[model samples]
Target: MQYPEHLAHFASLFKKRDIAHFMSAPWLVSSFREPVWRYNFGFKNDQNLDWRVHLCDGSLLTDPQHVKLLNSLQCWLIASTENAAGPGFTNSWAAQSASFRRTLTVIDHILQSAEALELVEHGLSALTYDVMCDIIEQIGTSSYVAVSTYDWNNRLTDYCKSLLQTTSPESIDKCLEEYPTLADITPLQLEENELEIPLELISRVRAALYINKMYHSNPNGGLNVNSIRVSALLYKDTLAGKKRLKPLHSILGFIWRRDRFIREFDGVPVTNGNPDRMTRRDLVLYRTAFTFLQKISALDFKLPSKEDLREIATFKVTGTAMGRFKNVPTPIIFKAIKDGIELHFEHGPQLLKSYLNIAKYSLKHMVNITGIPDETTISLLEPSIAELGVQYLGISTRSSGRDPGTELKESKEIYFSKLRGNAGLLELIGVYYGAIQLLVGATMAKRGSELRDLDPTNCLSEDKSWLIARIAKSSRGQKGRRARNARPIDPLAAEMVQTLIDFQKDLIEIGFIDQHLPLFSSPGIIGTSSLTSCDVYLYYKNIDLFCDYFEVERDSLGRRYYIRQHQLRRFFALVFLHCGYGASAGILQWMFGHTDPAHIWNYITEELPGKELRNTLSQALSERIATGGATHYTDVIDLIESKFGTRNVSVMDAEKLAEYFDFLMETDQMTMEPVFLESDTGLRVDILVVVRKQDEMG
Candidate 1:
């Protein structure tokens, strides 16, 4: 094959004799040509000479192991040179020989050093005895000697060789029967201070396995902590050459090994020559390393701290069952209340205060929604308000005029009546009051009272101030409710109210309310009455603002207009009529708080249309239902799904589902036939395929 110019350049770089060039431009040595270099450099102690000689020689360092051996030999030569030339050097040949002999001594010293051995030991930390045996079986003794320093120290070399030879698959099985402690051999080697294993190497192996698992499982492949941990161990073991398994085979091999271990020793004693109770120390070590890697990987690498590493390691040790001989302990939750004042300072006091007020309103609305007894809801909210940092004066159980609760109740009723008179006003006040306060407060806080009080009437008028005070007082009373009542309202209901109120208050203090209020309110004047009118005008003027506040967007003007409070009764009446409760008269009677059907009929006959074109659609729907027509229901669904796609079909996809629906509708497929899309039971499948063919003729 013809090589690219870059490859030719790489070849030349590899052939260069300059040591500096070889060291500095190491990337020039293509991985493909590594074998050639390896063969030439095998187990040679030639430090002064360039790598080009080793690459050209071909005989010695053919294998990667041989190349490593030669590199180690060269390192030994460098270390030994200081000890050479003292006694046996009369000639240059004798001097060279002495240097070579000293190099061997240095190599032997390195093999004996605890530090060097510790590095190797750490590398093997994630490997099991059986795995180590497998590695020996795969790599054989020669490569092992090159990668490892066993050749330098006879005693250690002999020990390793014996261990390797005795730990064959069959031998290991027998050993398990005789000595369960054999499972701890890797740890034993470390304990004896024989080798140092690098955690990095183990981590790399684990990472490879994790990536593979992720790739295979993708989407539906469920990943659990245990599986991930196991995968990591397998990866580490494979990479360290402690397991005779390929990278692709590690996961399966690990499972097989686990099964074999379980099957071979079902009830044997763990420590006393029983296979059933094998300690699995190697597995534990690997698991521990895996856990450490997982945590450290999750942390921000840019600011890696020693404390973080120690915490990760500690968690890994405990989390991975490294020390425990039995089941893991459950994590303990520790709780302590932080000072509220301090928390307020950190989070902004005004914001917190606003949250409390919002929480109160939210709770009140929730009570209204659930039709829970007002007294019970109020009792539940009292403590919540106290906790929220509101100082309460007193709660009057009796509805006295002097009591703030009674005052609030009266105020709320008045507010609601005004809402009935002009529903827009209620919405406008709800939308803007808190928001405007927040914006003005923040701006004032940032600037000064001089700047803040500029539009005091507009920004903090007496009416607005009274509104704030009333809301605050009500919130405090509401918070007390939770503490006093043993049996409270539904937990979710309480939480929702709390969350809504807090969110509203936050929006207010941040100036979001003040900024958007002008879009809805009347444009002129600054008197209290004018302000009230503006609030009322805003309430009705920008219905979209209210919808926006609730994150609910009306799709059509009809839908938007239909949302009016007065229209609600009419709509409900129409629904009843279409469902066949008589005409609009009966609907109005049932819907308008009228007790008698006859009165509703008179009103309907005298006024509004008893039925309309829109009502016809509803009547047709009801008729189809009465006739048990599947086609009608199916057609409805087809229309909905065609309009909304997967979004309208299920709640799981949520926004995505909605987006899909929008896409379908916008693409002009509103009348398209229904498609039975393949989907996970809980998942929404967006794409649609036509279930029925369209007519060929126009």
Candidate 2:
């Protein structure tokens, strides 16, 4: 039989090197085991660590000691409970009165309000089957038994020697039954120069058994933090060739060496022999590294200060800094790689600064040559230092590599420049276009013909002045009294309807409407053609592509300014809040199709800055309600002096003052409160406030 040249060469190495030394002791190969996952892009160190699981099924170990080992393993795997029993003990001595009971209930409610519990439940969804098995096996085996650093290659080699001396067809057939389709796998056969035989057959069996240790033990494998920690420790111990039992000493050459197994089960490190200390220290180090990686990954693209730079330098895995993490554990090394990435990220701002300095010096020289060197004009050429560090390494500008003069001649950019100058027109046009899409979608979605049977004309009526949209579904009430059927939109979306009416009339004269007289032939587009949802996406995609037209940076994550159709609800809702049209949560909830008022709180809080916004808003509402009129800042200060005998209202900014006034209106503390003011011309003016009644007030 002939073999490939590569196979023959690989077989020669097995003949020369003892298999047990090669398979069991990875430390002999290298002091530091390379990790499975690499942080930096480079050629990897050879992966020499291989735990043979396919051979050992644990069925080989059947003794009374094994049962005791299993029990201890289970005990070690049990989770330790941290008690909050101090409150319970305190309550035991205290009175069991109604007030005391009420206080306890309130405390419990506060405890439950924490968001950490919700986040933990979310994280639990990511625990996979392989992760669970790794944990459980580590606990049960006690870094002994199946998890051996005791060289099986040596044991197999000795067996092959005896088989070679007494070579027979029957014995070979029996060996083939166990590991079929293999020859010259052992040391003796390899020593005989049988290069044509499949020598990997023995190692392949070991690999299969190792896999079985992780997942094939049970149908529904289990997982917890303890299992993960313990498994990592076992892997470390195996690689280091520490605290392994001799094969001849264990019962049936498989069960735990009774003395060492007990120590392992007692929470002693198999490698270091520290009782009551298993893999906890190693696990902590790994976890700490993981946490650092997570933090670095989540860090926003901000320019790190001097202190942040110092902290980042400690874990960096590049240049001279890589020496700091050279001999650290694999997990820690990965963490260092993450740190290096963050360091690189932070350097972006510094790189930008360097480029600017070079530009500034060049500009000064050029201007000097021109004989009109103005320091201010040269300084103006420098860009402002952005708060965010640059994510993209390459240099880019709003002109898309073209000079500003050349860009100005482009039609798209010219049109965009005009639109930017007239913001009100831009907003009104966006609102009009967005409203058409929404109304059409809503009407179609309600009728259950959104995707399949879209005929934009079906939404139109005889009168071209109005359009309707289905905002909510009709539901049965008490005594089968059904609610109103798909409410009309003459008032609900009045601004959009009116804009559509005018737009349709203009387009109708151009002969663009369908036979049914709908405003859209199919749907409305930014261009002269009809559009759909797909068209809307393509429109925004093109807008993003033409970022130079809008004078904004293009990001890999998509548009920094280009608007999607769905964002219209959030846009208009924010507009309603900022413009003092309708700021209450209920109005926002209805407009945004949110069932819970709490969901709206996050949006409102994000929109309105200041840590004391909620408190300030509440206080302002109370003051306005007490006054029963639209109170100016001057009047409010007077009221404060009368109540607290002090005036501090003058310190507040105009923006803060407006926020308070808006808060009063949104909460309906005082409805349409009127105020009389004297203008600069000494003319008396009547001002109408924007407050509307809340549901409770009504």
Candidate 3:
């Protein structure tokens, strides 16, 4: 019954080709010469795989070695499909045909690019992991492609290991090239960033956010939009020089000149110009005052034409000629501030107060220099200034009240220079949520979507220790898989989660925001509904605003640092990996949920990701091991001693540690455990390593 080597492979290919054409999936077979897996995503017979999976440009498909490996891969593909519907209709990927084929296309790229096609005789061996890594390194830009490829292959590797039973390699995604190098992390500057974000920064940022949220939630949170719009207009026209405000500003220019030179405010001292000079520093106020005079005033006031000052007398309303009436200041200033009050309550004081102070200073300075306006102008201008000041400006003509700035300061609403005050209600809310989102994103290893979709009602368990979130990425191409994973959070993260829950509840209760939205939804955000989805990508901008507001500084190297959700996720992974010393990388992978990590391992869960990252934590671990740094790792060390004879063997020469590491990885499973060891400094140092043998899988 035993066939010779070539005959055995020939018979195996014959069986696989038969299985392809006769069994579960007949579409997979193109021809005996080359059984490339061609897929039809369009209709039942529509073969638009239009994308194809082939080996070695049609040259290697007939090779005995390739034929066998390709046969096994095809069988796995056929087995991967189940009878469910498609995307949106089902959660499991195999439930739909398209998802599996789409994944094969990603794999196809690696297959086509992989060199040394005959390196492995059959199936995806450890050698295939190396080939995959080589292709992964040359990739650019599309990081998602890299993540997806690794994830799908990891699943494939899992399937292979399950079949092999005793030869499982935990995960092939353990390559560190995807991470930044050690030098990239050193000399970490705030302006130019490093690979890792310091926990101290995250902590300090959280505290700053807490204080800011508390600080801003006062005085009804200044949701007022009036000040924001007004200041932006001013800033744009002045500094931006987009220079679009010409016509209106020009009109304002003349009106200002007329007011200053011809009919100067009543009580001020200097002799009024013989109808001449003027200048203006504008913002929304110039437009507002001009509009109040022309559009809102009953006087039908027309600005004086710059061509003639003598025309001031002719430009009057129903009353005496305008030039003769000295009372123009009071009525104009009063009407502009008063009428807009109902439309913009905060608008009058904050917007026009600065202008009012300027007017009085100019008025007083004129009074000191020389000319006085006639009695008629005096009575009108003086009384009007006092009235406007007392009522709208919050200034007391009777007794001293408070400095305007001091009053606003006490209200503690955020104010930016140039009147860009308090309009950040929307951005502030974003910041508040951004802080929570960053904290949650960093602490919880959820995908951006999972983090965005967290349910306020049930995101937490009754005990409040475990942070529960959905798992979708790994569920791709699998059926009936678990959809959610619950992992423990530190005390601070737990507290933050609770606070988030409470905050969402309050927003819903007040009907200020709708209920049933995800915790991060933009409910109170104008134009958004409770059912709308919020992308986590936008959270970084809000976080940056928070940083700018709080003056989050750079590190010692002066490189500017920016934080992204992915970086936070990686940092968390790194922290969990090295934290109590030799904390298990395997457990970190397990917690990440690429495999049924729960099935084969004990859940002393902890965290960390992939590609030959100089910054990849394996180097860190290797360095630690070489130095004999970690303490109390008896079992792994004993295993090390049993094989290599002594811990010193790894440290002996340049290549020995590499061999030692290889030996440890060759075992069924390796993990580090912490044990207290006496250090030279007399401190209690808890450090160690452990290895789980092939027999320990049970």
On TM-score, the leading prediction is 3
Model 3 Cα shift for residue 206 (angstroms): 36
Q: What is candidate 2's lDDT per residue for 520-593, written digit by digit as tens?
A: 22231121122222222222322222222223322234423322222222233232222222134344334434
Top candidate on lDDT is: 3
lDDT accuracy of residue 121 in candidate 2: 24
* Evaluation by TM-score, superior candidate among 1 and 3: 3
Q: In model 2, what lDDT does residue 581 have?
A: 20
In model 2, which residue pairs have backbone atoms overlapping below 3 Å? Answer: 53-209, 53-210, 54-208, 54-209, 54-210, 135-227
Candidate 2 runs further than 4 Å off:
1-415, 420-467, 473-528, 533-629, 632-698
Query: For residues 232-311, what per-residue lDDT tens digits would candidate 3 score against the true structure?
Result: 33322111111111111100000000000000011221111221111111111111211211111111112222223222
For candidate 1, lDDT tens digit of each residue in 1-698? 34687686455323423222222111122332342221111123322222222222233333454454344333323223222222112334333334433233223323233243342323213233333233323222222222322232233234233434444445445534553322321211121222232332322222333333422421111221133333333222111111221122111111101100001011111121211111223223322322222222222222124444344334311111111011000010000001211322333333334333433444446422123333432344334233433211111112212343442354534533433232221232333332332222211111111211122223222222211111111122113311110111222222222333444345445443433222213211111111121232222222323223332222223222102222222333333333232223333232333434344334333323322212222322333233443333454456555555632333322223222332333233322221223235321111122332234212
Scored by lDDT, model 2 comes in at 0.28
Give Cα-based local distance difference scores for all models.
0.27, 0.28, 0.35
In order, what is each prediction's RMSD in angstroms? 29.7, 31.4, 31.4
* Order by TM-score, highest first: 3, 2, 1
